[model samples]
Structures are given as structure tokens and as C-alpha cells.
Target: MPKEKRPRIKNEDQYEALRDQGYSKEKSARIANTPDQVASKKGGKAPAYEEWTVKELYEKAREIGLSGISKLRKKELIERLRNH
Candidate 1:
């Protein structure tokens, strides 16, 4: 038989582990494909999403390239940011 083809996963072990932990395939793949340097880096000093104004939240969503966010309210923006 021909060799089985597999996706180009940067971290196959991490992908398998994430899949076993019930993470969605896309989510698992995205996380597993992240570069080691980026993965180990810490987040910025931004405050909690809850404390951000609606405009700030909208701007943040745009900054992160999140789609369909113009219609989302403050609470929805918070949820989207947290889940993102």
C-alpha cells in the first residue's frame, strides 16, 4: 500500500494529547502548530475583558482579526475574547 499521508503538524505529540483531552480538531491543530517560541511566551498586560469598554472590546476583536464582531455587544465581546 502507499504510505499514509498525514497533516503537517509541528508538534504531533501535543496534537495527540490535545485531541485525547477532547479539544476540537481545529483547536488542537492550531495549538499544536504554534511555534515553540510563541507558545512559551506570556500574554500582554491588558486588563480583564470585563473591564474593557465596548469600543475597546470591539477594537481588540478587530485587532485579533475576529470576524462578525461588529454586531456583538459588550458581554458577547467578553465571551468571544475569553473563548478565543
Candidate 2:
């Protein structure tokens, strides 16, 4: 029998699942290392980004301190928000 190697991440299963879902390594590690109780309760209360107007998205980007949003179209803004 071979010994199983443990990862440094707090939740190996969650990390692997996130990776499989296409999340970046940094994002996966951050989410997996978060406490289960806190992570489960974490989520946005806002509506879907697609429903938001370009102006609304721009304001949100500004609020979040994102740069180079002044010239972004609605879809680009939405993509930026989701990736950010």
C-alpha cells in the first residue's frame, strides 16, 4: 500500500473541486483555505451582473477601485466585474 500525500491547503477536496471548475490556482487556494462556516455563508447579495446597466457597472468598478473602466463596453464591464 502507498501512503497518500497531503497538500498544504486546508481543504484538499474543495481545492480540487474548484480547480476542476476552472477557478485559478490562487482563487482555489484562497477559497479552500477559508473556514468552512465562513465560506459557506459568503456570497453576493446583488443581482446578476448581466442585468446591470453599463453606467451601473462602471460605478461599481469605480467603487471597487478598478482602473481603465471608462472606455469599457457593457459586456467588457461585466467580464471585468466577474473576474475581479
Candidate 3:
């Protein structure tokens, strides 16, 4: 029988540590995969959501698995993203 291959999880140690600290699997993976060191060194230059266009907001919301996306207004999408 062939041995099973381990799952490919980047920053696996940090991911497991975050899980132990009670972060959801999705959230943990997001954080673990983030280029935190690079971002902090360069600083996050992304504009705030309030400044983004409604279409951009919709795209961003959909990318993060927001539900009822087709029904959510731009304002509601912003709120959900903020609180997400």
C-alpha cells in the first residue's frame, strides 16, 4: 500500500497555533498565509473599503464567501465586510 501524503498547509505550525488559540479554520488559514512580515515592513497601502466602488465591494465580498451576495446592497456589503 502507498503511504498517504500529508496535506499541503503553508505556515503549518503557525496555523496549528492559531487553531489552538480558537481561530476558525478559514480565519487561521487566511492569517497564516498572509505576508505579515512583508506587509509590516512595507506597510499596508490598500485603500479603505468606504473608498472602494460598489462593484469592487461586490467582488471583494464574493471572494470571501459572503452569503446572500446577490441580495446585499452596497451599504450592507460594506457593513458585512467590516464586521466579517
Candidate 4:
């Protein structure tokens, strides 16, 4: 018989490994399929959250789908983003 084939999943090896390590299917797929493998990589050139302006933080929170952030103070926004 021909060798079994996976259905062309991007980063299939990583996905399988994540599954072996007990990640949920959806979470595994998201991490594996992220174009740059950001889950396993870190410390890019972006400034720390504390250095960002309140407006910038709010926008980032909005982009990340964080709720109750519209009226949050800068420190609160930072904490919320970190907690999420």
C-alpha cells in the first residue's frame, strides 16, 4: 500500500507534536498554521507594552478582541492585555 498521507496541513510536524503534548486540536492548528511560528518564537523588535501610548494600547486591545477596554486607564489596559 502507498504510504499514508496527511491532508497537506501546514507545519504538520509541529501540529502533531503539539497534539502529543496535549494541545487542543484548534489551538494546535492555530499555532502550527501561524505563518511565522510566533508561538515558539519571541523577543522581536517591537517596544515593550509599557512604552506604548494609551491610544496605541487601546488600538492593540481592540485588534486582539479585548472587551471592556474602551474606558480602561493605560495601566488597566496594559494589565488586561497581559492577562489575555
Measured by lDDT, the strongest candidate is 1
* Number of the top TM-score candidate: 1
lDDT of 3 by residue, 1-84 (tens): 984464556788988898899877777777778776763685478998889999999999889888887888778889988766
lDDT of candidate 2 at residue 39, scale 0 to 100: 73
Q: Predicted candidate 3: what Cα RMSD to the true structure?
A: 4.4
Ranking of all predicted structures according to lDDT, beginning with the best and ending with the worst: 1, 2, 4, 3
Native-structure RMSD, model 2: 5.7
TM-score of each: 0.60, 0.55, 0.53, 0.53
As a whole number from 0 to 100, the lDDT of residue 38 in candidate 2 is: 89
lDDT of 1 by residue, 1-84 (tens): 985576788888999999899886778889999998988999879888888889999988889778998888799889987776
lDDT string, candidate 2, 10-64, tens digits: 8889999998999978778888999978878857798899888888889999998
Q: Which has the higher lDDT value, candidate number 2 or candidate number 3?
A: 2
The parts of candidate 1 lying over 4 Å away from their true place are 1-8, 17-27, 33-44
- Candidate with better TM-score, 2 vs 4: 2
Which ten residues in a row are the worst by lDDT in model 3? 3-12
lDDT of 3: 0.81
Q: Over all chains combined, what TM-score does candidate 4 have? A: 0.53
Q: What is the lDDT of residue 61 in candidate 3?
A: 87
| Model 3 misplacement above 4 A | 1-22, 33-36, 82-84
